[model samples]
Structures are given as C-alpha cells and as structure tokens.
Target: MSTKILICIDFSPLTPRIVKTGKELAKALNLGVHLVHAQPEKPSAPTAVVHQGADPSLGREMMKEIKELNNLKSDFEEEDIPCSYATPRGKTSDVIAAEAAKVEAPYIVLGSHGNGAMYHLVVGSVAEGVMKKLDTPVILVPAQQRLDREAGR
Candidate 1:
C-alpha cells in the first residue's frame, strides 16, 4: 500500500496554503494525498423533528464541503497526484486524528491560524489538539505570515 499524506482543511482563508503545502510535500515524497474536512457535531434540538435521515441544513453543509473537496481532488488529479477526501462530522481534532490513523498516513498537514494566546485559550487550537493526539509528524503552515505578506507588511 502506498503511503499517503493526510491534509486537514477548513473554510478558513488558510486552507489554500495548507493544500498547497501538502501538495508539494506529497509530490516530493511521491505519495498520494487524503484531504479531510471535519465538521462540528450537530447539536441536539429537542423541538426539531427530523423526518429524513439527516437534517436538511446539515445535509446542505455536507454537500458544500464535499463539493469543495472534489474540486481540490480534481486539481490534484490534473497534476497527476492521487487524491481522495472525507468529510467527517465530529470534534475537529478527533476526526482528523481518526482519519490519519485509518489511512496510516505518514504525515499530517494542517494550517495554524495564529490566533493570540488568549483566543486559543478560549477557543482552542485544532492544530495544537491534533499534535497532541497523534504521533505522526505534522506540517503546520502558519497563516499569520501569509496574511501579513498579503497586506504588504
């Protein structure tokens, strides 16, 4: 089985950078890429009754994520890079780690939004959480630097 690189992406502005970094690493390593988008678990609404398998709003969100993932996969394919994706709904860190483990990925690539310490303290950091949960080496692409560069700082 060929080793793969697991890349976690979100709707953040840093997602493209993360994908690019992962693509470069995968190309260098001659490995396939597995993209993952972890959606937060849906909160229970006691008053809401669902007649369908899943809530319509959640279904729409999932479809949107899948479409984005497909576009990314197509880009990889155009470059002759093998690619696949998963949209797992759950705690972000747990979902990423689980997918990494499932695929036995050699490396996990993700973006660091570079939020301040106070922000991270209250909101928590997905990159930090994934690092803590997995032994696989993680490639953290810093978002702040990119933002600064874009701003001509």
Candidate 2:
C-alpha cells in the first residue's frame, strides 16, 4: 500500500482545520489522503433491546454520517486532492488507528478540541488514545490555533 495522510474526523466544527492540515501534508509529500470518521458506540436506554435489523434510530444516524463523509470527500475533490473517505463504526481512537494501519499511512493529521482535563477524563481523549495506540506519526492541530490563524491573528 502507498503512503497516505490519514485525516481523522469527529464531526466537530474544527473539521476544516484537520482537513486543511491533511491536504497540506499530502500536497507537500506528494501522497494521497484518506479521511476516516469513527462514530463511537452510543449508549442505549436500559429498556432498549438491540437486535439484528431492529434499530431505526441507529440507521438514521448512520445515514447522516455517510452523507457528511460524502460532503467532505467532495470538498477535497474540489481542491484537486486525491482523497478517499470512510465512516467506520467503532471506538473513535481504535477505528482511526486501524484505518491508518489499513492504509499504511505514514502520517495522521487531526484536531484537538482543547477541552479541559476534567472534560477529557469524563469524555475521554480520542487524539491522545490514537497517538499512544498507533505507531504512525500523528499531527494534532489545536482548535484555538486554527481559529486564530483563520482570524489572521
């Protein structure tokens, strides 16, 4: 497999910066881009019973994510970038790391929301987990920095 830059998406508004970083890296390295969006397993109500072909809500959520990924792919294509996207179902960090390995990506670019330590402890840090779990080099762009750059500050 050829080397590519993996862009991890978490449905955040900071997505553009992550994609921008991935595109720049790909352009500089003359490599392709693979966009990976991992939706975490959602907790169901205690009364909810999950069975095969039974979750209408889950289906709708999946459809929404698929549409978003397609839109992202289109954005990259418009930039004349070689881009492929996937929205895989699993733990965010695991899915992202797996995608990086699957595509043999030498570099992974993603954004950090810069939430506080308590927030991270409660919600967990996907970027941190990805960096520790993956062997590939990862670049994490901070959301505040991206915003400042965009604002010309």
Candidate 3:
C-alpha cells in the first residue's frame, strides 16, 4: 500500500514552499498526497436593526487558498507527481489531524513562520497545537522560504 501524506494549507503565499517539500518527499517514498484547507467557523454578526447582508466577495477572496491549492497541484503534475486536493470547513487543527488520521497518513508536513520563542509564548503556535495531537510522523519546513531565491531551480 502506498503511504498517505497530509498537507495542510491556508492559501498563504508561504504554502507552496511547504507543499513543494511534501511533494518531493512523497515522490521519493511513492506516497499519495491530500492537500487541504480548513476554514474556521466565523461567529455570526450580532443582530442589528441597521445591519446589511454579509459580503460575498469577502468570503470568496478568503478562499484564495483554493486557488493556491490548484496552482500547487499544477506544479506537482508538472513534476509528474500524483496528488488530490480538498477544501474543508472547521477548526484548523481538528480538521487537519482528523483528516490525516482518517486517511492513515504516515506523514504530515507543516511550514513554520520561524516565529521563535517570544511569539509562540504569546499568541501560541497553530502548528504546535496540531502536531501535539497527531500520531503520524510530522515534518516542519523551516521558514527558509527560498521560493523567491530562484524559480525553475
């Protein structure tokens, strides 16, 4: 059976850096990739007599992650690597970890922002929270972020 790999994405420009790393590893190990973006539930705006409808473009723009995922898929295909993508809604950590376990992913790849000591101490790390709850081997792509260093390298 091929190894299953889970990659969490937020459509951040930083996502490709992380996805590329995971794709390389999957190619080396002949694993399948599940690229996902988990959208958190937004609290409903409080009832207001003067309130108007929620902005539609605001939500579609938020789904930039979906576009980024498709772009990554294209990149992976150009490399001749096979991958599948999905978009889910819910808490980021729960959605990622749950899907990973569901697919029996042997590996999970995450990219950090290098927000070292102080930042983690304050806002808390989303990646840290997800890793702590998953049983699969997890990889962190250090925030080297060298994508702009060169393209087609």
lDDT of each: 0.86, 0.81, 0.73
Judged by lDDT against the true structure, how good is candidate 3?
0.73
Best by TM-score: 1
Question: Per lDDT, what order, best first?
Answer: 1, 2, 3
lDDT of 2 by residue, 7-120 (tens): 988777888878888888887888889999886676432223353434567667667878988887887778777788887768888899999998899999988887778999
TM-score of each: 0.84, 0.78, 0.76
lDDT of 3 by residue, 17-79 (tens): 788888888899887788877766763233221266665554556566567777878887778
* Candidate 2, poorest ten consecutive residues by summed lDDT: 44-53
Which pairs of residues clash in candidate 2, taking residues 3 or more apart in a chain or in different chains?
A: none
Cα error, candidate 3, residue 12 (Å): 2.4
What is candidate 2's CA lDDT for residue 82? Answer: 74
Tens-place lDDT digits, model 1, residues 100-146 = 99888999999887778899989899877888999899999989676
lDDT of 1: 0.86
Candidates arranged by TM-score, highest first: 1, 2, 3
Q: In lDDT terms, how accurate is model 2?
A: 0.81
**Lowest-scoring 10 consecutive residues by lDDT in candidate 3?**
42-51
